[model samples]
Target chain A: MPLVNRVKELRARHHLTQGDLAAKVGVTRQTIISLEKGSYTPSLMLAMQIARVFEEPVEFIFTIEEETE
Target chain B: MKRVIIQSLSSIILYILMAFTIASFASTVTHSLAALKSGVFVLEFNFLPFLLLIIFFVVWTIYSFRTRPNQQMGFGQWSVRMTEFSEVDEREALITAKATKAAYVSFSISVPLFMLTFFFYPLFQTAWPTYPVFALVSTLIIANLVYMTTWIRAYTR
Candidate 1:
C-alpha cells in the first residue's frame, strides 16, 4: 500500500521550504522532495520528527493510502 | 549525490590504476624469474616506472578512501564509512541499501561467470598467468559500476 502524506500541504501552510523541513527533521532536502512526491516512505522516527516539527500527530500527517482499484 | 558521483568516479580510476599496477608488477616478477632460470646474473631492471606506478596507486587509494574533512564520521559507524551506503540520513541510507543490493546481485551473478573462465586457465596459464588477478579487479570494477548506476538512478528518481 502506498503511504499518503500531507507533507507538502502542511509545509506550505506553515510557510516552510523543503530545505527548512528537511533540516528541522534531520534529513536531506532530497528526502523531503521524495516524501512530498510520495516516492519515499519515512521511518517511524522520521515520521515522529516530522510530526513534531508540524506540531501534529503522525496519523494526521500520514495515512495508509487506500486502494482505488 | 554529488559526493556519491565523485566517489564512484574516483573508485573507477582507482581500480584501473590498481589493475595496471598489478599487471606491471606481475610482468616484472615473471621476467625476472625467467632471466634467473637462464642464469643471466646481470640484473638490469629499470624499477623507476614500476615504483612510480606503485606509489601513484597507493596515493590514489588513500585519496579515494578519505572522507571529507567536515564530515564527522565515527570509527565504529561502518555504514557511514561505506561510500556506497552513505548513511548521513535515513533516506540516503535507504537509497544506499538499494544500491548495495543491486551491487550484491550483480556480484553474485558475475562471480560464477568469472569462475567459468577459470576452466580455460590451463590453456592460458603460460600465456597469461595474471588472468586471475585481472579477473578479480574486473569484478570489483563491475560491482562498483553497478552500485553507482543503481544509486544514481534511485536518487534521481
Candidate 2:
C-alpha cells in the first residue's frame, strides 16, 4: 500500500480487538486483519467507518507515504 | 450465539450420523460375509443389522445434540485465509480461456474413445444392448460439448 494509517495504534489506544473494529465498520474480522497487515485496502466507506471508530478525520488517520527519491 | 450454536449442532450431528451409518454397514457386512462373496453384493436385510444401524445413528445424533459448541466464532470463521486463491482481475479471464481451450482439446480427443466403445459393444452381444449403454454414450457427448462451450465462453469479454 502507498498509504499509512494509525489503525493499529488507534485500536490499541481504545483497547479494541480487530473483531470489535470490524464490527464497528460492518466488515468481517479478516478484513480488519488484512487492513492492519497491509495485505488489502479498504473501500471508501470502510475508510470513513474506520475514521469514525477512531474519532479522527480521515486525513488525520491515514496519509500517503511518499517514497524518498 | 444462537446461530453459531445451531451451526455447530448441525455439523456435529451430521458427523455422528455418518459414523453410525459406517458402523452399521460394517456390522451388516460382517454378518453377511458368506452372501457377499457368492453373489452380487446384497445385504441379508435382517432385522438385527437394521436395528443396530438405526440405534448407532440415533445414539450419535443425540450425543451431538448434547455436546455442540455454544461459543461465538471470530470473523475469520467465514472468510478464506489464503489470499493467493481465486484471482479477481483480467488475468484470471485469460487463464480461464486457456483452460477452456485445454478442455476442448481433451473432449475432442475423447470422442473417438466413446465411439470406439459403441463400435465394439455390438461385437460382444448378439441381442440389443441395454439403455445404460446408450445413456452413457449420450451423456459423454453432452458433457464434453457443455464443458467445451462453457470453458471457451469464460475467456470472452
Q: Name the best candidate (by lDDT).
A: 1
Give the per-residue lDDT digits (tens) of candidate 1, residues B1-157.
Answer: 7778777776776677666677767787778888889987544455655676668667754554465533464445523454545667888888889998988999998899999999999999998888888899888888898998888898888
Candidate 1 RMSD computed on C-alpha atoms after optimal superposition onto the true structure: 3.2
Which 10-residue span in candidate 2 chain B carries the lowest summed lDDT? B78-87
Docking class of 1: medium
Itemize residue pairs with steric clashes in candidate 2: none
CA-only RMSD, every prediction? 3.2, 13.5
Compared to the true structure, candidate 2 yields what TM-score? 0.34
| Fraction of the true interface contacts (Cα pairs closer than 8 Å across chains) found in each model | 0.67, 0.00
Write the residue-wise lDDT of candidate 2 on B26-126 in tens digits.
55675578566786576753365456556755664455335433225333542322111122322343434554466456667666666677766767544
lDDT against the true structure, per candidate, is: 0.81, 0.55
DockQ for candidate 1, C-alpha atoms? 0.80
TM-score of 1: 0.85
